[model samples]
Target: MSSIIKILPDHVINKIAAGEVVERPASVVKELIENAIDAGATEVFIDIEKAGTRLIRVTDNGSGMSKEDARTAFLRHATSKISDDADLEAIRTMGFRGEALSSIASVSHVRMLTATPGSSSGVMVEIEAGNVKSLADAGAPRGASFEISHLFYNTPARLKFLKSAATEFSHILAAVSRQAMAHPSIGFRLTHNKKPVLDLPLSMSVKERAFQLYGNEITENVMLFSGGRDNVHIHGLIGRPAYSRADRTYQDFYVNRRAVKNASLTHGLYSAYGDMLMRGRHPVGFIFIDIDPALVDVNVHPAKAEVLFRNQSQIHDLLRDVIREGLRAHGMPVISTPEATG
Candidate 1:
């Protein structure tokens, strides 16, 4: 038999990688918004069309990239967040692996326009199926904007897997809402098919942001808590037992500002409530965990939606105790039960 091994082309490699990063329209929104926040954007605007199958645009007033940097952003593993292994030990930025742009461009049509604060001119680049169609100097404000169209256009298998338009739009809204809650100081707006969906102004604190997003009913029912132990700080709003939700949709967790879905977090929260919450009813609140970056690994997940803690048990116990204490301090009855540390 002849030699059968062959290195995959760059375009092929990117498409394969896109499978992990760009799971759906929401995934594209997530990566782009994180990039905007990492760039220190104070305001972000998202516009969608046909549930993002036709168009998804994200604009931010952040520190824009240079012409050379914008041109290089489409190359896989080309990142400004981290330069060496030592830098990985303390990864704080929202994006570091540098795979998002490349993966997204490979699966859709992309038009990017960016300009830095001191730059006299901006740059515009268009790419289709991982091939650059155009790159030119243009006039733009000091920020970055990306317009992605026809998501999964080159891959029929992925395109067919997408859910209904309403379902997809819900996911996109959830992703944007998570970012909005995580960074309350940043302003965010969303529009779908020329209809306004969300318009959140700058909020000074998480509580204020909650009011803006959920209105007075939820905000009034939740109480703020702040405490930490063993270098793990926990601070955010916790819902009162009287105002419980039917599902976990209202429950949100964040570690160092990155939204995550962890069983340990959910378990600890429910355990904290104990018999105080009725059966089948779940608590609703935002839980923020802050710990040393070196102690938790964010690189474990391709989408960076999860983290591996150095001491999982410690986190579980801390979260349980913090919420328990907060509830008790507020005059809520607490059923003292055996502490369960997972």
Candidate 2:
């Protein structure tokens, strides 16, 4: 028996992970902005040109890092958020899975300038095609400013799959709007080719934030929910029967402040909606979940956009009950709309 396994290079592993995480400009936008949010940024600014194909620059007024931390942030699996299995179980922060920065750096030419408050200087690090080109001290403003130029430059195949500039830009804007809606206290702004597309100056409440992103139709139809059982709890907004979507794009889920996409949980919500939505339509809502972190695994997904729950059924039950109650509270017809009206 020959026991010999080849070890993959770090760059190769990161590139493969990038394939899962960086599906498009939209995914990049989501991951980077989420990092900013995790860093305690009260204000975030995003600038993109050529729909982020040529450039994607994110500037955040957050708790910026020291030079050492900024340099280490590009390393795979290096994170300050969680250290061990115990730390994983109670993830109070948005970015415990430190895969986003590594995956992105693998596929793009990244130049980052980061500074902490009261620091006389900042560190400027340049990475080209997964290789560090330079690291030097530079004069820069506080907080983190990342400039990703020639995105997917090393992977032309990925570039070919990208949509037109207008379409990609629209997708990026939609993602920014979604995050901004979730965090009302966080001021967010987006600029496309030096033109301002969105300017939200810190909303008063989640309801106000939702109204700013979505129209009054959605705001009025939204049903608020918050409940807890044992080690898990749920808090979110589910759309009333009147406000639904053609698909699940409008549905956003967060586990302990980290955005995730759990299809099983999504199904539970749909089941609760009943006949209010047809087979093809989906509901519009944000589902924020809180669970003992040990019971869920976020590392299974390269994008960190998904998780595995130990008691999926229990979580499903929780989601269904809340949604059902929300619907009932809104006075949804006891019978089908068509039948009741008939």
Candidate 3:
């Protein structure tokens, strides 16, 4: 009998991979913005049209790629972030997977114009459905700009999965807000349908960035909390008991500056609040945990939004203790165990 299995073509493989990396327009935004940050960009500007279905553009004043690098950047598993497997254990950059560009390009038409600071001219590369349509010299600033048109255009099924424009735009806004909060030193601007949405200048402190994004009403009720033990550091703003939310929607946690969703960490936040928070209410806060990169694995998910900790219990206890102390200092009541009270 003939062999029934065959290796999929590169284009087919890319389309499949795109499903994991580019779930929605917001996913594209997240990947592009993170790539810019990894490029050492101090300023990032994002523009979206029709809630990113029609257009998505991101420009950044960061290290741009050379002609060769730009051409190879869309190839699967090609990355400048890591040289070998050893680097995975100590990953520091926002992107090392190297699949984002290829995945994104496979499903959409992509135009990239990039120039290094030392280069007198720039190169523009146009790709459609993972095929390069054009590559030529172009005049551009000493940075990089990517414009993606008709995302998931070739994949009508994926396009059908997208939510309403407003819903999708809200997701993009949340993503941009998280990235901006994670890196306060980097300026970020966002516009949707040619209307200005967010314009945050470079900030010296996370609190300042918070104020810009969340306004003073929320920021005023937040208190800074910081503490660490055994080489793990936890620091960020926590809302006072009065600033609780109806759900965990406002709770944000970052491990090594990467926003993640971990149940243990969320429970730890609730534990920190203890009896101070009423039943069915959650706290509005941001908690950042810094630990040796080797102790945390960021490869647990394709989106890199989930992580595995080497010592989860220790980290959980540390988070609880740190926020509990901050709450106590702010004159909030903390529930004590019956044993401890006795």
Candidate 4:
């Protein structure tokens, strides 16, 4: 009898890997945007059709790839972000795993046109279900444009798992908003089905970007804070005691400009409010933490949304202390009652 074990083909392996990275349309948007930013893009435009089930396009003015690089970018485990083991310890760019392009291409139709600066022409590569369908010369700017369509089209199970168009678009919007807030200097524009959702130009400060994305009502009610100790630095806006929320949806945390979720950090943030916050109420604010890359590990998770800090306790204490002092210095303003106003 023949051996029972068999090796899976590259196409099959790619589709299986897609399960981890390309969960939905929003996941595609996130990967593309992060890649654009990693390429030093100053302006990024995101356009979605039918809540990204039909089409998703990310155009950026960044360092585009050459013909050879563009063709090899879709290969699994191929990345320019890191070369050796030591580089992983100090990961700074948003993309490093090299699984994003391969995983995404396995589940959708992808058309990438890219050209580097000083190049007279660009290369356009069309792929479907992990197969390169076409490669030709295309006229394009000195950057890259990724056009993805029919997400999860080849995978019926994945298609069945998606939510409604409205619901999916909301998640995409939230993801884009977080990236925009994290990088205030980058210009971002979002359009859904030919309708404008958000358009923000390059902002000089986080406060200005917050006002543009969140509006005056929320930004006005928050106080800015900046402090740090040793090699760790923390800076962001913290809401007043009166400006509380029913949920933690309003809380955004970024470590080294990468969005992350940490239970200890979240608890520390809530504890800083102390008795000022009403029970079950959460504060609305954004916190950006900057620490030595060696002190944190971002490769713990496949999505890279969860990080492990080398000194969790010390960082938590620093965060709580800085926020507590910020609140004390910027005393909460009194809100007049209805009867008093009348």
Error of 2 at 78 (Å): 2.1
Query: What is the TM-score of each predicted model, taking all chains together?
Result: 0.98, 0.89, 0.97, 0.95
Candidate 4 global lDDT: 0.90
> Positional deviation of 153 in candidate 4, in angstroms?
1.0
Top of the candidates by TM-score:
1
The best candidate by lDDT is 1
How would you encode candidate 3's per-residue C-alpha lDDT over 186-228 as one tens digit per residue?
9999999999999999999989999999898989989988888
- Model 3: worst 10 consecutive residues (lDDT sum): 333-342
For model 2, the stretches where C-alpha displacement exceeds 4 angstroms are: 1-5, 334-342
Question: How many steric clashes between backbone atoms does each model show?
Answer: 0, 2, 0, 0
Per-candidate Cα lDDT values, in order, are 0.94, 0.82, 0.91, 0.90
Better of 2 and 4 by lDDT: 4
- Tens-digit lDDT track of model 4 for 41-105: 99999999999999999999999999999989999998999999999999999999899999999
Pairs of colliding residues, candidate 3: none
Give residue 41's lDDT in candidate 4 (0 to 100): 97
lDDT of 2 by residue, 6-98 (tens): 889999999888999898888888888988888889999999988998889999988788989987898889888988888876666767777
